[model samples]
Target: MHTTKRLTGAPGIYLLAANALVSTSAYALNTGTDLNLSMKPIAGGMAGAAYTNPQEVSAALFGNPATLTRFKSLHFELGAGLLEPNVDNTQTNDGYSHTSTSAARNYVVPDVAVSGEVLPGFVLAGGIGVDSGIGADYRTSPVNAGAGLGLGGAGAGGAATLPLVLELLSFSGNLGGAWEVTPDLSLGAALTVGFGLGQLGTTGSTTGLQGLSGNFGGTTSSVHNISLRGALGATYKVAPEWTLSTSIKSPLQYDYHSILSTTVNGYEQWQSVKVAQPLEVTWGVATDIVPNLLLEVDVAWKNWSSAALYQDIFQDQFLTMLGGQYTLDAWQFRAGYSYASSLLLNSPNGSLGGLDGVGTLPLNTAVPGVLARNDLTKVVQTTLAPVVWQNTLTVGLGYAFTQHFRLDGFGAYAFSENTSRSTLALGNYQVTASEWAIGAGANFSF
Candidate 1:
């Protein structure tokens, strides 16, 4: 007589975990939180918020719209950024480790805005920009696949030959206005509309000893969505040499629908998912300590703990399955520098980032044995998807060729960050991330 033991539970758990990992890993790129790239080259390089300056041009729309009241005439600006990022993942199992690097790619982010006094002490402005964005392309490797399937034990080697690929993109649009209540105080508000898209592909054997392997092999999936949110800000000139400003952004959420299809394997599936853009609050101060030079500083916070999309999906799984928290508060700092033809109105500024991991993952069934027996979580955390928080430094310059024409440029470098997660079941998962960005804009004033 012949008999066989079918490990039904193991493959199901692996597939489910793989699905969740795919979604979460898509957002773990250079930006830290989400796609919060600074649109103005001047302010971006200096890592500063141009909140207190009335002569800041259209870039002011990103900080305190109320600063728009500082503009005395019609202003228009346009610019774009070249962002390059490098991501590397290392997975270890049973004391064996392997590293894989993402393919090189350049992302172009655009910015445009206009502001003018529609009424005395009132400014009307509108613009379109990238609120958040990130993506990575990776080639399939036997080592990575082995790491992903190693949780099923040494016998799972046959399944590790599968090839995988991933890509993601997101952006937003804004419209707003500002009003000066008194010579020293101003208020501003804006609405943001968001959009995102993603794709995942894989190739390999569609079937194996049990049913666990047939679903995803030779499959491709795509997801996209739209969302909305709002922002409010205020600025006050406390003294001729000092200014204070603050801004708050509401949470943005999206319901992405994914459609999966396999041609060579003949399979298809559909899924619905939710993503959150955390709430943010910022405070800033600017001062002129000497002549023709200005300095500015800003502190900002992101409420990641309240990001329902991440908490609901990855948090519970991270805690119950991996014994950790998926959500944590994020903070950012920026300092600015400007040299002008005049006291301060003719100068340029810059800004930077820290602690921003801008993506989401899914939830799989909690199988303690699978997690405890091998470094399955490490593979999921490292090779499949990992979050990295980075620090940045930047510099900017601006020149006014004529009263009506001005140009600004900036360059920034983000320090590399290495992150690792360890579990008794598998071993350790580590990832290193870094990036570089450059931007320039032209402004016309009438």
Candidate 2:
């Protein structure tokens, strides 16, 4: 068990901002382009976790393939977005010393897709999109005593300045079909593939202090990786306006290869890290409330059980997260909650937990003695924080400008907290984030 007081005492404002970005990205799991299937109107009532009802043309690729049988022609969709992150935080130790930092940044992303029926009972569809939609930049000044030589002290020993940043992007594709097994029941199958491109940047000061300013300077690095994924689904019509559905989104496997380049004593050196990706599954249902109005609800499960302690250079100390979604005609709404296990709090040397994963021990030891004492190297696990917990709510609306063209928009708000133990390093920390999405599409029949 973890005490709230111990988890709440460590004051770091930037952490609040970081949690927001993470929550927003997590909410994107049910409504954003990567998982939303561009069918917000049919996804408004229930959380976007359902695999049974594929009301919109775009969603058929991931939900129920049998939904494709309802289409008579060709359809296409496109979307783009922007996100902002802001943070304010401080850290203090047993001594009278402390440090605070705040930062904000913006991110922009885009998506596109198309689908069509090639035969009486056969349909073909494909799309391009992104995922893991979050990142951050943080810095702090006014070095403290715990950061250098005490219970929370930095092993490096000195007054210092710090800044860090990370980004992840995924490009994915889909191909599948909806077969009318019976007049009212349809079965579907699909294959999904996603490729990831990313970069990591860091810059800071370890000098201008008492004993350790001579070890480092500004540094930066970048890398790339790819992942493969797939899924299958089925839907049964119980009545003229009611449908039941279920789907299994195959797990993603990843191979990451990267290099870490930084300046030490003004000289450049390189290191490498690697890790494997986690797997996820979802199931749900949909019903027509009235003409042109549809409702959907879903429940999903993610498998972090396949997660391990150390496969290669990376360590998998964290476990799974859970979420849900709902949709209605012309409007879509979504909400989700999840618990994330911690990798930072478990590794002896802060090493990456899987193949191609990176380590943080060297980076953790980069600070001066005075500021090193209070440096938090590990976050002990407990029920309260159990690593990390995130919650989110999303809203979306769509309008048909014409019979062939339509427009859709979405907004989401999210928050997260990580309280692992009952100490200053084990206390509670929070973050909030918001996102806006807009899309346009056209449908034509032959």
In order, how many clashes per candidate? 25, 73
Candidate 1 per-residue C-alpha lDDT over 1-446 given as tens digits, one digit per residue, 9 for 90 to 100 = 11112221323444434333332232221222453435465566565445555335555776667777876588888888888877787756665677767664588878888888989988888777777666545544422433435433333332233344555566777777888899888899888887867554443432222324334443445777788999899988889888888888898876655433311122223444455767777677777655555666655666654564344212211100000001112211233332111111011111001111111112222445433322333343344333453356666666777778877777776677776766433345577877778888888889
TM-score of each: 0.75, 0.65
Q: Judging by TM-score against the true structure, name the best candidate.
A: 1
C-alpha RMSD between model 1 and the true structure: 11.8
Candidate 2 regions exceeding 4 Å error are 1-50, 62-66, 85-89, 95-105, 139-159, 207-220, 261-269, 289-293, 307-351, 354-389, 415-446
| Window of ten residues with lowest summed lDDT in model 2 | 23-32
Worst 10 residues of 1 by lDDT: 316-325
Name model 1 segments beyond 4 Å from true: 1-32, 35-37, 52-55, 140-166, 200-211, 218-220, 259-268, 312-363, 372-387, 424-426
- Candidate-wise lDDT, in order: 0.53, 0.40
| Cα-based lDDT at residue 190, candidate 1 | 81
